[model samples]
Structures are given as C-alpha cells and as structure tokens.
Target: MGEQQNPFRTGGIARGHRFADREREVARIGQGLREAGGKLLVYGPRRMGKTSAIARALDLEQARGGTVARADLSTLSSLADMADVVLREVTRAVAAGKGFDDFLAEILKRVNIGFSVKQDASTGVPIPQVDVSMRSKPLEEQKLAVGEVFDAIDGMAAEHGIVIGLVLDEFQEIHRFEENFSEWNLRHIIEQHENVGYVLAGSKRSLIDRMLEADGAFYRMFDKLTVGPIAEDYLVPWMEERLAPLGDGAGEASERIVALAGERTHDRMRLARHTWFRAQQAGRSGRGAVDHAFAGLVEEDADEFLRQWVHLTVPQQNVLRAVSMKVKGLSTADTLQRFALKNSPTAVQAAQVLVERELLFQRPGEKGYFFDNPYFEAWVRERTAIDLGMEPPE
Candidate 1:
C-alpha cells in the first residue's frame, strides 16, 4: 500500500520521499522574505512544479515561525472575488497562530461578513457561525473591496511585527475576467504596503511577461524570478536517496528513471514516481533494474500527456509539427514555408502563441525553437517519423 503513492502526483505537492530538487530556490525565497518585504514572481511553463515549489517554501516558512497564505486565483472571477478570498484565507491563517487573534479580528472587521456567536443559555458554551458570501460585484465595488482588503492587511502588519507572505497561483488568469482591473490597483497597493510580501506565480508565460514588460500597467512593479527547470545534479542525488530504502539495484534504477524524464524538473519527478510504482507492481524485484521496459510504460501512456497539446489550433499544430520535424534547426522563414503558410503575419502570430503556451521553447544562442519537454518532442518525433538532424538552408 505504501508503494502505491510513490509515482506521479498529477496535482498538489509531492509528499513522502518524492519531492526532489529546489534546495537553493527555497533558501533564496526564505532569504528574500527576511529582507525588506519582497515580492517574488514565479513564472514557468505549465506542469513544471511551480505550485509544488511554493508549497514546499510555505512549509519551510512555517517551520521558521513565519506566516504564509496561498490563494488559487484561477477560480476567482473579479477583483472583488479575489480580494474576499485573500482576506478570508489570510484572516483564518492569522487567527490560527497563537496570540494573533487580535490581528485577525482587525482584518476581519473591514470585510463584510455575518458572524454569529451562539451561547448555550445554561452552559454558556459558544458556537461560532461564520456565513461568508461569494458574489460578483460592480467594478467600483470591487475596487473599494480590494482597497479595504489591502488596508486591513496594512493595519494587521502595523499591529503584528511578523511579515505576511501571500502567494497567488495562476495569477495570469486574473486578466481573463477582470479586464485590466486588478493589475494596476494591485501594483499600487503592493508599492504602498510595507510588511506585506507577495509571490505571484503563473503558468502562462506570455501574459506574465506582458504584465512585467511592455507598457502594460504592471510594468516594473514586480521583481522577476524565472523558475526554470530543476537542476539535474539535484534530481539525481535526491532520486538515489529516495530509492535507497528499496534495495540493492534501486540506485541504478533511479538513475535510469531520471534519464527517461529528460531533465525537465516536474516531468523527471513525475516519471520517477511512475517508474517506482511500476517496479513495485512487478513485485519490487531487486534483480531487475528500471530499464527500457519502464521507459516503454511511459511511452505507452504518452497520449495522457498530449491531451493538452491536441487541443491547439490547426495552424499552431502545423507549426509545432514542422518545428518538431526540423529537430536539427530551421530558420523562422523556412519553418513558415515548410508549414506552407501563406500569411507571414498569421504564421508569426501562431508561432508566438505556441511559444507562450510553452509548447515550444527557444534554444538559447540558437536560431530555431525546440519542444520544452523532451517527452513531448519524442512523442511528436515518433508520431511524425521525421529526422530533425538536417540543418536548414543558409
């Protein structure tokens, strides 16, 4: 039963001995928190363990007597909704800490909510009834609510010396519904607030980049931190340590598993967990190391990974396929021509979208783009049966 949870966590933080790498990132975040209330923006391609890293960081913060609150902004529709959620969670978290009830009460007073304290007539024991409302409001109301939430945060900070760290996951999604509503206001509040720290993380690179760069409203408001793929050196040692308890051939098997994952941090950890589960299912045989057979299992399940890729537009699909075929390298012009795209502007637009989605990543100091994840690249190669070693025309 214990062996069952070893492989592949599709959602949430990796638990047990499954978490690998990011020691340096954790330390850096902790140090930044200790410094003059810092804001960290963790941007990476999807499924790269951005959330897991934040979760792990929060755990470390708690161990050191710090307060951390996380809010998933994906489900939130407007600025008001976001503000309410953040305030509610932050208030609850502050209330949980010893001697922090007063601080929590101060924040709660600014927000509109029904709170009932029922006392038994005879026993005098009280029951707390907290009825929270979730409703979308007008833009003006949203702005006020957001401002009040920030004010409450400021008030709490003034009373309690401890700094507050708020992590908003999928922050890019705020633009989808809010219509340039929250970004500028958030920037203003963050700029004004002293003891409040923020970590805005998102899977959408283009949105995040536009918010930080370009003449967009949030320009230069955040300290950029690109959470790249996890280091291989850290992954290798961590995997060996995780598998050591299994048996004699476990260390070698772990290496083979990591190799199969192709060094993309999240994929490597996910694949390692999957391989471990497969090995255990095969009776935890100490003699048989994780090898091509386990690799084949991952390959067989490739469709599961490609589901998101399959949803791309036809033009995006064609461009991605063309890039995959030209594995060696292809000039931007040649790639467009290879895909038989007549509209040069449209092709460029499609390519840019693909890059933003992280379906493609630019090869540093190189001309052409490459698939962000090797597994996806391999899947594309196998599906197309194309050799990408040939260089494009000069």
Candidate 2:
C-alpha cells in the first residue's frame, strides 16, 4: 500500500492517535464519565479542541468496555431532526442495526402518539422515517417530544448495567426551539435522568448559557469545563517530536509552525501539515520553508476567501479589515472612524455578525477577536499589508 497520509489533520474530530497535549483534560473527562452518570458542560471557542477532547475521553471509555454514543446536534435543522438523531445514536450505540424510525417509534410511544412509521419509497429495502401528525402543533408540544426521547434513551441505557456516555457536540443547537424552549425542556429531562453520562460541547459562551439566567433553564445545570489554547510549552515539544520522523530540521521546525498558527491546536496541525509537505519539496526545513508554505496557503484558499468576503456588507467588510489591520479599540469611535465605518453602532453590529458567523473568534477570557481559521486571518493581514512581523531564516 502507499505510505500513510499526513499525521496532522484539520476540520474534523481528532481521534486518539492524532490528538495532542490534552492528556489532563482527557483524563478529567474520562473520570467524569466513568463515575456514575457524571455530567460535563465543556466550553471553548471554535477549533480550540472541545469536541476532540470529548471524543478522546469517550474513546477511552469505549476501550474500557463502556458504551458511548455521540451526535453532533449542529447538523440537525429541525426540532424533529434533533429528536430523531439523538434517539438514533443512543439506540445504535446500545443496540446495533435498528433504524432511527423504529427506535424513535419505540421511544415516542408515550410522549408522541401522533406519529407513524413509513417505509422507503426511494429504495427496495425497508428504509423507514417517522412522520409526526403534529405538523401545525404548538412549538411547546414539539419541543417536549424531543425531551421525552432523551428520557426514554436514558431508561434503556440504565437497564444495560452501566451509564452510557452521550457526548453532544454543539449542544447550543438546542436553542433552535426559540427563546429557552429546547434548552429548558432538555435540561429538565436530562437532569432527572440517572443512566446517561452527558457531556455537552459548544463554542459560543452566550449560547452555551442561553438559559443560564437566575430564571433560566440550564443555570448551573452543568459542571463547566473551559477548554483553552494548548500551552506552547506543551505543544512545541510535542510538535518537534512528531515532526522528527519527517527528517532533519523537524527538531527546529515546531517554533515556525507555532509562530504562524499560535496556540490553537487544529490550526497549528493544519499549517504544519502544509509546512511539512512544503519542506519536503524544498529538501530542508526552517522558517523559510514555513513562509513559502504559508504563501501557498494564501493562494490555495484565495477563491474560498473571496467567496467569504463577497457575501459581506460593506460595513462588515470594513470591520473585518479593521480586525485584519489590528486596529486598536476595535469598536471605539476612533478605530471605527479610522477603519471607514460610519459609527460605533455599525462597527459593533458588524463585529458581532462576524463573530456569530465564526469568521472571527473572540477568545474565552481574551481581549480581541481573531479569525477562527488562522490561515484565513493571515491572508487578510497580508492582503491588507498588516505586517505579521515574521522573518524567514537566511
């Protein structure tokens, strides 16, 4: 067979082999799950390794002969999709081969009496999907059906002699029910359950606590764990060690990777993957190779970057340019005036929109917002002549 692909990966869950520098966090999560139905509310900005950490912990749990089910709630578009998927994952993890519609019908027997099972018209096999008769039902009743799905899953998992670890990535999607409907309802049902070790991961702090007010649903519902940037001291040595198999300057190459990508784990891995291949082409490794690789990244991502930019309003584009330029007091009158934005409100609104879209990421407990994708941010700065201040080696 051809040699294996690059060890560094980006844009998806990092499993046991590739995930780095999160041993302590992984151990904490594993211990929580190993306890009797332990719960965790893991919070971090996007790409900061929250999902990876949960996946790693769950992998360890599975290794120890535990049942672990996971679903990315963000992919579900409707309240019905959420109910179907959660039931699907939990059932698949506990009892394999049962389709989502069958498992869902079994669970909803009590809460949703107005749904039917239908076979696939698109195929020869019996691929079934549930059809709820409550098409015009009140949103509250619809939300409650999803909550009951969780309750039923908990009951089944408890019967199996151990707690099932259910990791819900992007748990904030629960708020799609409007106001606090989904979060409040789910929180109530989840809290009363005893057979599910639930770990919820989300990037947006505001949405994570959408129901966190004193009168809120999930106010103190979780034992919160904040995932942050993997410290450079821990990361650089690991990078140097991993990069060594590639050849000569892998020992000296980690710093350049960190310099370009800073402390975000996935971004560093991606840029390093590109840098390693670039160094392979040049037959050496150093800061110089890092530069060529980065320039190549700017080129590779040009079309995508333009696609992102053209969708922005002029004010949003101006706010992004200000961020790219590293202008001081980003929402202040001085900065907005300097960046060509008309007023503080416009600049503030633009910044919030960018943040919400995750084109920009405001670090947890940090001062400024930066591009979620580091390479994209680098392109912005270089395109605008914002001087990243890195120097290629001689």
Q: Which candidate achieves the best lDDT against the true structure?
A: 2
| Model 1 lDDT, residue 64, Cα | 71
lDDT of each: 0.65, 0.71
Per-residue lDDT of model 2, residues 56-171, tens digit only? 88777776777677888987667766766665566555543221334444555545524444443444333223355543466666677677777777766555456777888887
Give the local distance difference test score of model 1. 0.65
TM-score of 2: 0.82
Off by over 4 Å in 2: 1-4, 96-144, 331-338, 343-346, 363-368, 385-394
For every candidate in turn, the CA RMSD to the true structure comes to: 5.5, 4.9
Best by TM-score: 2
Question: Model 1, 1-394: lDDT tens per residue?
Answer: 3634453454567744566667766666665554445777888777777777788887777667777778788897666567766765565556444426565446457655444455435544333333334244456666666677766776676567777777878877767655546576677767777777778888766677678876875676677766777766666666766556555566666667666565466666666666566566664523244554445654876887578667888777766777757634343566656666556676667778878777787644677677777666666656543444443321
lDDT of 1 at 363: 49
Superposing every Cα of model 1 onto the true structure, what RMSD results? 5.5
lDDT score, residue 10, model 2?
Answer: 85
